[model samples]
Target: MAERLHDPWLVAVWPGMGTVAMGAGYYLMAKLGMHLWEELPARDLFEVDHVDVKDGLIQTAPLPRSRLFLWKDPNEKHDLIVFIGEAQPPAKSAQICHQLIDLVRPLGVTRVFTFAAMATGLRPGEHGRVFGAAIDRGTLDRFRDLDLTVLEGGQINGLNGVLLGVAAESGMQGGCLLGEMPQLFSQLPYPKASLAVLEFFATLAGIKIDLTELESHAQDVEDKLETFLSRIEQAIHQVEGAGESAIPALDADEEDEKKKPKLSAEDRQHLEQLFTEAKADRARAYFLKQELDRLKVFRDFEDRFLDLFKK
Candidate 1:
């Protein structure tokens, strides 16, 4: 029989855009001193192509394996079971999810939460908005009350998204908190975005976490990025002005026209507030449009299983 837990909550974190969601989960595990409890055997779930070279001798080795960590705080109201995946299941993922559910059933885990990121084309100054989605209205309302943006109609894809479908099979409730990442930073880990999600997670799970370390790391990255952009802009100007005879007064007027007004702290906050409201309005319209097309259906007979979570 599987081991029993004290009313545990299962939280699954996986890699996605920006790697922000999964990185935040890892940070939490380390900060909270969570212990390794079990592992999902990777013999069939992932490919074994990695090789180890030691002293000119070649040897094949298994790749990184997915694991589950446990944090049991007897003084707290709930225990946490975190599933950190090194690689997503290669085939028969639905079956894998079902097996996971069965394994945790004995632990009295009926609530599941997943972490992910949403790519919005906003700049860095507009970072830190977190969005949520759930299969039930009660969960959605809970997030709304916390002032988190609740996605009304868009679909969530990948392993994080599929867990919700699995949860519905047993009448359990599940929610996903997706931090907003700018499209420009989609290729890198956005710690600021992750910080926002972690803050909301702490609130939702009734846990306390010190985010001082992550905050410092995020600030450092932002400073380096700004310096890099300034260099690139300078290079562009040099190239554009090459082999040109410039008239001084004309150049000054052109520079003045190119400059844009910089918003103050208060003004930036106001602009972000307005942007959030506008986004919500558009989401409402999208929700209504989806309702009208409820009867319209399309089919794709592709054999790509990974595509299921990409929807």
Candidate 2:
């Protein structure tokens, strides 16, 4: 059963782990009870991810779950709690967040902050990035020291996104700490992404965590990934030199192939036009929403001023 979360001063976190041991050590410390507080759950995050449930396949969706860790300071008043994970939900990404609100609201939490990484397409020889956003002005102000930039066109499409929405709906303050990572590293869990996420988390949590172990683990993973890439490149080079495969043609248009008993030029043009229109329409709709939001804010201010002087 889902825990009835009370109103907690909850901290939501979702760091990539297990795929490689990069950020695993930070999680490990929390596991070893070496920190200021002990994890309330008898189980760890990974176990929670792999726990089995087979009830005739009525429904079996993995993830969209969170790990709850709680610690109480004997002399302090409120419990310090952290929630970690991505919830399973649609682009509206909300289901798991509802569960978190249940757990924290009952516990007296009124704030929810999530952690994530912003990925980027980087050259193999270039550096990475770290960025963030917040749902509350105060939360945004607090993390300003992390050198966080304003996310102007920000929208959440993942679990972290949903949690932020939960915070918004519940009138709770929320924020996200993100690390910019390479797109090439997107295929699997990237250690660089893990490092960026944890370091950023440490800054906000005010929790002193020694990342030395995590760093060592990240180095090992990085070496392995680099080796894998080198092998793949070498294999591709060998295949190309053998001449079994021809280079992809950039000029093979429908007009050239139409008379050869294939698709007509008109059909190909129609398909391309359909795809182009779909992409343009999606982009236009997104911009329209932004414009509407900006206009609404201005209108709200104007309405307030009009009422201010009214008898």
Candidate 3:
């Protein structure tokens, strides 16, 4: 990547916990119509080349691309540059960070924002809070003024987390916006968390985005999740009620014959844990939905009230 972008504020979003942050970043790219400006060449970062075998032939699919995109917000003085990646660098991610900083420096990138998910064990259906961490006071103050929660002591692992520190080393202002989500959803693609992140980013970056698509997606997820949770709860109840009756008895002759092992106390304990986690996941989802509803109502009233002043 050359010094193609000049004086642009940059945001780097990588796949991470819940896939929330990456989804939000990609959503912004689509909504803002960002154009691919330069390439970082995934070849330099990822060690393994991913390939697919289709039918009888082996197809070497294109390597994962890590690229920079540009979106000139006509309304703003500074331009926006976004770095989107399909895969994180396998090794020496620190070197990758430095390379990114070098690429953006000539572009006059003084600030970098990264998106991430925070597993705070917060209950579901509750409003997923946005947390902020920054390298400089100015950027930290901006977060404070935005009323974003400041993240306390904790290490944010991975490229999405480390990029901020690297940018700060180069005298660039750096910050990360994190959305709260259940720990169990770490491996899940959490649209709700992504939506929360985007909501915060909209306010923090002063970018006006119509979140209708994300909102719809979030609603659909919640709908399906509600049904799933209900079924899980029912199953848990049945399992608990059945007790020992749920397990098939071993023949007494099994003392001398080989027999299948029955569900042990440990197995029951594990099942109980799963049931508990399922309930918690459902609760968190419910609270998040409630939070969205409140926001929707508020936005509706705000729009109508503003319309009253329109000519």
Candidate 4:
């Protein structure tokens, strides 16, 4: 028998450009402390085309696995189901989506979401803008309200786009969130793009999860990329005998800081109480983590927050 879930929203992800989709999916799974719910049989859909060899001996490899992780909402608003696939099959993507829908529909999933990457001519230091594409008008309106760049006419290409198309055919409400990344670095892991997608998704789903770790990682990548770009620009300038570098600096508006959430005295007290409870019972740590995330102070208490799980 399938486990009963409350108003669950399904978010599916697979390996793609910039690793945006998979990064967000894994982060959600870790922060929410979701457990493995089920494994979708993949042998029919995914066939191994190559094998590894050790000491000139061919070794058989297992087909890629597709898994589902469940996070029951503490607020009873909506449970979350994150589907992570080890690899996208070379063919029959639509059929795999059909199988996925059939599996989740019975568990009361009405809305589906997929994360993807949009390769653009963006600078490495620039913030990645999230693009939105919906299966329905109502969801489109929500995207507009969020000020997301609506994908007017383009192909989303791959399972990230195909799954939403399948969901629409099955009368499901869903959309795809595409994070903008540099076309030149499309093959690189862009955690900034992943962070941008997750920030929007967290708002859309009304779920709170600590994103400080992701944010820090994104910042580190941004700094490294900036340095790399600067060196390349300097080399180009020397080659061209130019008086000034051709690369433009990032706009001041782009560097503006986002306003942090303010916490009340009551909220502070509540946080302390939650921390105490979490210390006694490790299972309560997720709830405390959520509160800390909501207040945007997860970094301040990160060490202590992680201490809850110390055995």
Candidate 5:
């Protein structure tokens, strides 16, 4: 049975560059104290491409899930529904989006929003600008009123953008908010971007949620990434100062391997401890992700790292 909602608006999210969309979605769900509403059946849309191996044993991994959570407004202005997809379908994303809208539309949802990350040349120390694209004139005007940079062109890859297109086709009003992230650190989790997107959304939606924790986390990550970038800059300067013959000539593969930092045993232990802390408090997961990225081992722990927000 569907719980009766009050003029609900839908916000859908999926994992993407810098974990921006997923991070914001999870934070919203946590802060709003939203409860799981329903899980969209998507077995036919997603496939298990691989199994997990732990302690030398192969374990069957479950298919990705798409879930919706509901939060009722205390002031009765409007309700909120957050849809978190564990992973985007490899194909037919538009079809699944149609199914999602069909489920929520009956509950009085008329507006949909999606969050994503936009890779730019901006440095980590710089604030991530919120970019927006709306499906209609009124929504675009709303975005302009919020002082967001309107996305004039270019594509928003994956379901974050595709879902909004489907919503527009359904005659619903919606838009996408894309937070700017450093292109060089696209593989890393940038909480600053997540914070920017949420800040804009909260204001636009006339909702109040404490952003102090996310603000602090964003600053922490920005400082770390800035420092890391400085080190790389220094290394580059030193290399450039040296004459061509002063540096050894190496193949592209070897150069890439040489540039990567080797993680020490102590670093691994620290990462394990951080992961444990993150498991206990999901807010700390970004910190764990930062450490993994610094050590260039995020890919190795990506699945388990993302699992921290599965609930």
Candidate 6:
């Protein structure tokens, strides 16, 4: 026998800064806002107790090898699937998702969702627009009010594209909530966007996300990111400008400048410290670098993600 698996119909999340906000929000609600967010504290609404994460690739198709969590509604038997993993897409993440779906849905999982974000030119001051797309039109119509500027945004590359396609194939209900964080949000946390996504998810799940911790973290992440972007912008200006083709046109002359990262001891230590924060998601961290190495544009912005969770 397959040992009679558990936690089907779970609410899955991937490990990233977004997951941090989602998990933090869930934690705050379960711990302090229980009176308002859920009818049951531990088992019904937030099921962190059910998380199972592996060290390596858990899925190989279109999804990340997600660490799984099962959120159940106490008053009712209804549940949501949460997978927390460092996501890539349509390569390994899909496989992990399919495995999870096969294991859980037979038990009664009717819907699934994955939390992620997109790097955009939009800044936090711009209401942190939350974009959502569903596996089906019905789901799209459902989230029309959350303020998505790009109904076509989900068409972009990576896990966002594949997961939705898989959801459609599996005959399961699925949706993705993508928050617009400034392009600089990559390689660092972005709290404003994270909070916006959580609030949007809470509305869908019919629960309120406790935003106290998220608000605090958002302030910190925002400050650091603000500084980082200023530097990047300044660097851009000193060299040229932040235009599409203005990055000094990395030609032969620039090729020589592309050596190892030049850093002071303090900067090296800080980089190491950043890696430590992602200890649970080493694969993602490694792959991110590899992808960065392969990127043609600014050595690729895709891998510079500020992923902060086991996702």
Best by TM-score: 5
- Per-residue alpha-carbon lDDT of candidate 1 for residues 219-294, written as tens digits (9 for 90 to 100): 7656655554555566667677544333122222113322533446775474445434423442222222122112
- Global CA lDDT of candidate 4, please? 0.82
How do the predictions measure up, each by TM-score? 0.71, 0.55, 0.72, 0.77, 0.79, 0.55
Q: How do the candidates rank by lDDT, highest first?
A: 5, 4, 3, 1, 6, 2
Worst 10 residues of 6 by lDDT: 33-42
Per-candidate local distance difference test: 0.67, 0.49, 0.69, 0.82, 0.83, 0.50
lDDT by residue for model 2 (116-165), tens: 55666653334555566787888888767666655667565566677787
Cand. 3 TM to true fold: 0.72
Q: In model 2, state the lDDT of residue 189.
A: 52
User: How do the residues 229-302 of candidate 3 rate in per-residue lDDT, one tens digit apiece?
Assistant: 45556666778766555544322421221232445677547544543442444222223323323333312232
lDDT of 5 by residue, 63-133 (tens): 88788877899988879999988889889888888899998888888999999999999998877799999
Which is better, 3 or 5, measured by lDDT?
5
lDDT of 2: 0.49
Judging by lDDT, tell me the better candidate of 1 and 3: 3
Q: Write the candidate numbers in order of decreasing TM-score.
A: 5, 4, 3, 1, 6, 2
How far residue 62's Cα lies from its native spot in candidate 6, in Å, is 22
Q: Per-residue lDDT for 3 in model 2?
A: 37
